[model samples]
Target: GAEADKGSLGPDKIGGGAALADGVGGGSALGGGSSASSLALEALVRGVRDDVLALHLDVLNHFQAAQEAQTRAMEEMQSRQEAMASEVASLRRQLSAALQQRDEFRWL
Candidate 1:
């Protein structure tokens, strides 16, 4: 009867005396679990930061494209303005020559 009372169960058995004896009030029971949860939280924060950074890059790209298009339009307008100014100057010279010929004919 005493032998049966003192018999040792397998180490993996739940509620075994050996397992309870080993769990001598360790500082915190969930230390490993808490560390794992903290790591997961840090990972989530990093992922959100990366997403925001990508969005910012996209916005910057769009702004640069718009600026380039505006610059091109301005250059084309300037080119057209220069051509119109040259045409006006040429027409003024032709009008002046015609008037001078008409005055000489009237005097004859």
Candidate 2:
């Protein structure tokens, strides 16, 4: 019954026990014997490293895109501010000229 229970545990239930029995456990769970487990561990590590590198690159790309968008927004805002400043200056000059004309006519 103990053997039957062990068999019934399955790979997922026993946390990769079947993989260990199959000589591909990466030597982390089962005892080390040959270079095959080492190779498997190396392959797993490489795969994880590649995935992390890909994620890092993706994040960098997103950050660069966001930075570019922010730069464009700032430039647009600066242009609008300059345009508003120019309009305000023109209005002030027109008001000053109109006041001068009014004063001259009143004195006449």
TM-score of each predicted structure versus truth:
0.59, 0.65
Please report the TM-score between candidate 2 and the true structure.
0.65
- Model 2 lDDT tens row, 3-78: 3233332335434423334433455444564477676775675566556655665565566666767999999999
Runs in model 2 with CA error above 4 Å? 1-34
- Give the Å error, residue 93, model 1: 1.2
Model 2 residue 37 CA deviation in Å = 2.1
lDDT of each: 0.59, 0.64
lDDT of 2 at 61: 56
Residue 70 lDDT in candidate 2: 95
| Candidate 2 displacement at residue 61 in angstroms | 0.5
Top TM-score model: 2
Model 2 sits at a Cα RMSD from the real structure of 16.0
Scored by lDDT, model 2 comes in at 0.64
